[model samples]
Target: MKFLIIRFSSIGDIVLTTPVIRCLKEQVKDATVHFLTKKNYCGLVENNPHVDKVIVLNESWELMIHLLQNEDYDYIIDLHHNLRTWKVKRALHGVKSFSFNKLNIQKWLLTALKMNRLPDVHIVDRYLETIKSFGVVNDGKVLDYFIPQKDLITKDDIPLSHSFGYVGIVIGAALNTKKLPVHKLKELCDKINFPIILLGGKEDKIVGDEIAAVNEIKIYNSCGKFNLNESADLVRNANLIITHDTGLMHIAAAFKKKIISVWGNTVPEFGMSEYFGKDQVSSFKFQVSGLRCRPCSKIGYKQCPKKHFKCMELQNVEMMAVKTIELIK
Candidate 1:
């Protein structure tokens, strides 16, 4: 059977869908797995061995639909169940489709009503459940991130200070609410005794510079210099990872790196935490408790809704640094 797995955008959410890809390709008899994603994120899965072909949602929606209709897939696994995905399923109307339940109502309850109706299962497990009818199960493995040979980093790519080993800090998030403020990041950097590498996209270069300026010798800002796979290589080489609830965090989990995940407005209970399947990789989450306004949105905001911003301002950076030290040692 041919399976077309759909997850259109973003780094982390697409990374979370790897398990389903693996299971579908491995367990399902003679399965040919085709993945559909936005043009920007085609790099995340284009090199994946499990995917037979990658279909891009390019500038032409008509072209995208034209490409999908030609595949004649046996089933569609909709990992990202948005209106757009609904349209894709509609275009392939006759194909049997299994969609991953997004649990928007449960998310609304937690974020808005402060009611916990969400299942304790991780989003990965929930994603896999979408294909339960096919007898696909979690293979007890880490998330998959395949870096092309050309994109892999060499020792000369990093500074001598971090050449031996360093802690990887993901300094940017999709939204500001999910990020540790620049001040907090600087504080965390100041406290860590180990060599550190600040990672992010071009948009984060200024902030990365600000944080790296805390101690130029100890902190090397690689933001904006490397592409996504190169950044993943940096995360792969790190002695430890200190990150926000971002895509690199998921990539670090893919490498089974010891991760110190810092949370602000978002919580791990949303099931987006670092998942190692049955592997017992050391992972710690730091979030300020007792903040009623926390998780104000299912995703995140540009800034804290509550002016106080206590969800992040109140975090214990000292402890996060201490944990980094402990884990690195």
Candidate 2:
């Protein structure tokens, strides 16, 4: 069977589709798995052994559609559930297509009214539900992220004394509302007794540097300095991970590293929390309860709706500090 799986963009969302790729390749008879994602995210699944081909939609879905039209795939697993994938299914006439249910209305209800009537399923599990007809099971596995051998960060990369131990902190997210404030990050770092390493893309470097500058403890600002896989290697080696709801947080879940996931505008109830991991001990949610303005957007916003930003502003930084220390110990 030749299967084409589709998930368009974003780091964490793309990473979350790994289990579907794995189960399809392993469970289906003579399965050849292909994946379609945005060009920027090609590296996320390029090295994945379960996937036979990684096709990138480089800003032009028409070009991708033109190429996919000729492949004559046996199955089209639409994990993205967007207009583009809908078009792809139409073009690939007669091919067995299974699209994941997005549950947008349920999400809208929760975001609009704070009503919690949504199903108790995680998004990853729902992704797996699409292929149930193929007799494929989830195998109880979490997401998979395969870093290229060259990207692995070795102990020698750090100081000889602290190389064996360090806390990996992911302080960046696509939305500003999801990120922990710089002051709160500094407080968390100060409370952490172990050596620290901050991780994020280039955009986070300034914030990371500012946080590093104020804290007395040793903190390595690796943001913008390393590529995605190299950063994954750092997360792989760390004793524990403290992250916001970002791509690296999902990657840490892939690595099964203990995570202290900090939440802001978004809640774990959205079902995008860290999946499969051993000793995945704790998460810190800093949202102010009973704030009518909370969850103004299903994803997040540039700033709080009320402008007070109490959801994140009112978080207990001292409690986070205590949790960080406990995880390290």
Candidate with maximal TM-score: 1
Q: What is the C-alpha lDDT profile of model 1 across 143-247, one tens digit per residue?
A: 999999999999999898889999999999999999888999999999999999999999999999999999999999999999999999999999999999999
Q: Top lDDT: which candidate number?
A: 1
Q: Please count the clashing residue pairs in each candidate, in the order shown.
A: 0, 0
Candidate 2 residue spans exceeding 4 A from truth: 59-62, 277-287
Q: Work out the TM-score per prediction.
A: 0.99, 0.95
Cα lDDT tens digits, model 2, 55-129, are: 888567677778888888999999989888888899888898999998888888888988877788888888899
Q: Which 10-residue span in candidate 1 carries the lowest summed lDDT?
A: 290-299
Candidate 2 TM-score to native = 0.95
lDDT for residue 295 in candidate 2, whole number 0-100: 68
lDDT of 2: 0.84
